[model samples]
Target: MSTRLGWTAALMLSALSLVPARAQDAPKTWDVPMGGNSYLTATSADAAKRGGRNDRWNSPDNVTSVYFRVDRAAELNIALRAKVPQGESRIRATLAGKAVEKDLKGAETADVPLGKVVMKAPGYVKVDLQGLKKTGEVFADIEALEVTPTGKDAAAVVLNYVKDNKDNNFYWGRRGPSIHLGYELPKGEPTEWFYNEVTVPVGSDPVGSYFMSNGFGEGYFGMQVNGENERRVLFSVWSPFKTDRPGEIPEDQKITLLKKGEGVHGGEFGGEGSGGQSYWLYPWKAGNTYRFLNRVHPDGKGSTVYTAWFFVPEKNNWQLIASFKRPKTDKHLTGAHSFLENFADRQGYLSRGALYGNQWSCDVKGEWHESTVARFTTDPIGRSLFRMDYAGGAKGQQFFMRNGGFFAENVKPDQKFTRESTPAKKPVIDFKKLEGADLGS
Candidate 1:
């Protein structure tokens, strides 16, 4: 057999082996563990009678629907554990375009089967709840959703289904949201530092932005390769505030630029978590590997400091990106993630792929650990509107994320790196030669 065919077969076998044999009999349960993707607006958690919290308190005006993914076509027993409010309440539940209605009464909670839903394919199962009669504050309190598979070879079916739908388009449907792959630190084990090596891949779309972030939401530190008309390497830090401009950001939540390289711009950009952003107009070529490092530790003064660094292979040295101070919080690093997405128009069908690996994180005690696992997830826009194509998997030791275009296949994360590999080579740019060069628009 050809070498490529041999590798393909091996990968298929490995993927299938990851599925537990008991999954055939085990029913898929949706709860809090499913993360933010499971619930929508107005859907809050309520105490369940049996134990654990039930996703409930959905009203007619708001909480209209819920979404979940199914691996294959199967006979799924769709049932809802809920309590109907006082007076007769009509709930019209639809799954995969199939609709069913139940006329419920009283305040007692019970498991109401919404009948069998035939999942025709491997995709999201959107359950829309509509109250036919407008009465009372809420229609019902949804306790849980039980999806028990009644088909044969459930485990095998799910694995095969994923393999078939793994590739997603860049612009529409499956790949629009930044596909994230990273580890969320366990509670109490906050990360003091984190770093990763990534090779920026060429993208079909030149308008999107690729982000490698070490921390989530209000506070984060990382690098971005903006693929606008002029390609640039952007290193930034976000404070825990929602300010319009960087200067307007409070001192306590500001990220100060201590130093920068030639041609690098330092300032604040508007948007979420406004803080400090440093950009260098370097036309980073595709397929070249780059290393990003971030250290989060407490500054002498009561605040925390986030420092970013980039290692250019050609320069064989690490360059300082920026340092930002986050006041009032001395917490450790929380979320570590990377994503490839487009920020251009919806019709923009551009696609991109990137390899990320050698991810290391240090705890407050100064111990370091290599992260090897991550939970894959999509954004709301990608999950709902754009069925964009996207997929992530290990390419050897490295893990890669690819999205956009229907034919895009998974790339092997075989790129390797080490601490001793630095200071070995100079960067592609000749600082002396570019000294008098004007890279203009």
Candidate 2:
């Protein structure tokens, strides 16, 4: 066996009657924990946590859903691991409108079988569980959704899910994979400016989706669907201080706010990595191409200033988003990339995509370098094989990436893709005009 094989692979091999299979393949029954892979999509964010480890769905209104994948057709016998204290409760489980109702009256956890169904194809499956009626303190303390193949052809079935809670993957796995496109840049060329355009197809724009256009070594610039009523153009830069807590940054290492455009809010953001964050609530629409431009230049005094601008086609003008100077750093933009990610885990079940095109980087010598090639990659979630729902490649002259929907047949990671360059479609930007627009006092 290859030492590079994951623990899930080893487990699958051991359970497959000594027959080998691919990574994250479940030859036996797949026990997908409800706390890890389930979400209450119809409830508020506060009510959704009721489906967590300690507590579970009690309200009949909370529409809880769990998801997984099967590599082949299977006669799947579905069951739920749960317990109801006091009186009895009812749960209606539905898959493709084939509904099964189960009564939960036991105070102790047990595998309550919800009958069987024949999946005629290979793909992701979503099981919806809803509370019908209950006479107890809560509907039930549900834990996991177990699926066992019982048909004669079950021996060839392969299942995929969040196999275990290792590496705190339960939280990370729920949100799915974050996919990227690394733009290939010329060697030895210092990039002072990076310009890229992104267009979200009409139906591809989903809530919680971040369509990142320009990503450098230090930070990323993107637009995100915050909610049904809110969207934003966001930009952030990590502090060289290297701390997860923004307050811990030293005075000299703190990100200095140089300037910001009107309607843009600038503040310190923490959690992933402490950094200065800025955003503007701009209602950018789908199907309309938006332009992103970023400039990275050293201040000659051991600091680098980053300025971002957004161009809206409706206005036919560019708006300076924000600018910040990071201390203890002196370098031009390096490692240019773009990514598509789902920021809200509750909305992870929804599909989203973004089209990135017209990548051009201006060197310090003021030469415009056309970037027609990019390397496809993903975050650790995809690399770990924990989630394989991300895809990226060249579509026409633009590069596109889709993630978070659990669609099958993902693009292989770490593959290089080259888009046909449209040299005539290169951006004709007025740098001087951008410099003159709303300079902060």
Best by TM-score: 2
Q: Give model 1's TM-score versus the native structure.
A: 0.50
Residue 363 lDDT in model 1? 72
Using Cα atoms with residue i matched to residue i, what is each candidate's TM-score against the true structure? Answer: 0.50, 0.88
RMSD to true structure for each model, in Å: 16.1, 6.4
lDDT of 1 by residue, 1-441 (tens): 111100112222222232345454465433311112222323223422222222333344333444455556766676765666656678888776788889776676556788777766665565666666635655665544546666565545331111221232212232245677756454456676677777766653344555564544334444444544466667666656677666677766666655566667888777544777777666666677776666666665666666666667778766665555566656556677666665542222345677776677767665666676666666654454333356776666677776644322332232322222222231232222322111110
Best by lDDT: 2
In candidate 1, residue 366 scores what lDDT?
Answer: 59
Q: Over the stretch 338-434, how does candidate 2's per-residue lDDT look in tens digits?
A: 9999877666777899899999999888789899999999998788776778899998899999987778777889999999998998778767788
Query: How does model 2 score by TM-score?
Result: 0.88
List candidate 1 segments past 4 Å from native.
1-175, 184-190, 202-205, 211-229, 243-252, 406-441
lDDT of all the models against the reference? 0.53, 0.80
How many collisions between residues are there in candidate 1?
22
lDDT of 2 at 39: 63
